[model samples]
Target: MATHLDLEEQEQLDQIKHFWNKWGTLITTVLVIVLGGFAAWNGYQYWQNRQGMQASALGSAVEAAVNSGDKARIDQAFGDLRSNYGGTLQAAHAGLLVAKAASDKGQMDDAKAALTWVADNASDDGLKATARIRLAAVLLGSQSYDEALKQLDAKMPTEFDAVVADHQGDIYLAKGDKAKAIEAYRTAYQKTAPGVEYRNVISVKLNALGEDVK
Candidate 1:
């Protein structure tokens, strides 16, 4: 009986290892994000007043350019922020705004560039994860399936788990890999909290694949 139980335990361990190998460190990272909340992304209380004011000014310039509908101006303003205030929340905020403007103008490359910088340089994991998720969406729209998946490869805040898996499902589905798509959607559905509207969205995706949301 002892030998049989040991075999069963080993099998379970192997199954767990297989899941870990597939998902990398996200499972562990998810736990940390929940316990810690990785709260720094909420604000930049440590910045000196002058530095904060300067960043805010540069952020305003980026917004003006976006409002002007001038891509060149947007580029120039965003360039100034990232060059001089790259580490500030204002810079990260500008990146997101620039990406939206770029996407609206159908400048996929520009959108990717802005989002990539935020993903690579944002001060906190939650913000970086936001960039990665947006970058993946842009890549998916461009039909760069592999590249999109790469953006989501890193461990992120637990809050982003559902979004990451949903993006993966879209990428896999775009590649016509129904099996992988379904698996990714299932992961998304399970991770999403009950009664969240987004969880219902994942359920719809799974249902389209002939899979129950259970």
Candidate 2:
């Protein structure tokens, strides 16, 4: 009976060895792939956190330069932010601020350049739309009427419908196309939500044009 039990145990050991011999490499490969994926995910999370911190710090530098009213410093900090962290929200915000400062200083070319960058590269749809409209305004100021109209002609999100129509109205008005301006203004007023002060402003514009919001 003891010899029989010993033989049975030896048989079980041999079965296990045979199974391992058949599948050991496959099992190891599977484990390596799963573990590698988990490690890669962890590394990505760590890198994203580090990037967010760095971008936040750079954004603070931009805000400081803007506050000091130092164009050179503002330009430097903004350039750094754009070059190093352009994918971050902070960089987009800095672009808008820089454009506004440049515009206010009558640096229309610089303003248009900054706004164009933001309009092209901002991660958020809303920011892109804002930048485009602002760029159109700068073009309109420079009497680049065709370019201004082109900027307004790009596809935009529904949330920008009213504001974009309003901008189109402004462009048409500038072009001495009062009939088109009135039509655009009517579209803007119609799209504007109830209870917004912007709607009232559009109403005033329509009134000035000898047309009421339909």
Candidate 3:
């Protein structure tokens, strides 16, 4: 019985060796490819984490600069964030904060520059849309009606459609195109979420243009 068992084990070992002889190179190649992909994925994850940390630190610096009303610091921090971590959401958020701070400090050009960076380089679609809206507002304030309209022409997330339309209305009004302004206002009024407080403002604009919303 022991002899029979030994023979059976030997046969199993022989079968495994034969299988390896037939396919060892192919199996090793496949395993190496799979393991290499796993290593690459892990390396990418590590790189992303490092980038995120760097962006977060820069974002904090930008926030501090904005809080202190230090325009120069804000500009420097924003530039670093944009250059090093533009792919991160924190970069876009920091840009918006820097833009708002600059705008509040009466630095319209600086504000517009920051907003333009966000509009052009933000990784998130929603952030880009927000940047476009803000940039349009700045352009409108500067009386650059065509440029404002172009900013508004960029695609926005669905949640931003009403606001974008309203901004377009403002741009048209600034341009003295009351008819187009009224059309835009009406579209904004219709698209705005029901019961939104801002819809009343849109209604007023439309009403002022002789387009009653009953």
Best by lDDT: 2
- The digit string of per-residue lDDT tens for model 3 on 103-189 reads 887899989999999999998999999999999999999999999999989877898989989999999888888988988888899
Off by over 4 Å in 2: 1-4
lDDT of each: 0.90, 0.92, 0.91
C-alpha-based local distance difference test score of model 1: 0.90
Off by over 4 Å in 3: 1-7
- Estimate candidate 2's alpha-carbon lDDT, on a 0 to 1 scale: 0.92
Q: Residue 96 of model 3: what lDDT?
A: 92
Q: What lDDT score is found at residue 31 in candidate 2? A: 99
Candidate 1 scores a C-alpha RMSD against the true structure in Å of 21.1
Q: What is the Å distance of residue 91 in model 3 from its true position?
A: 0.7
Q: What are the clash counts of all predictions, listed in order?
A: 0, 0, 0
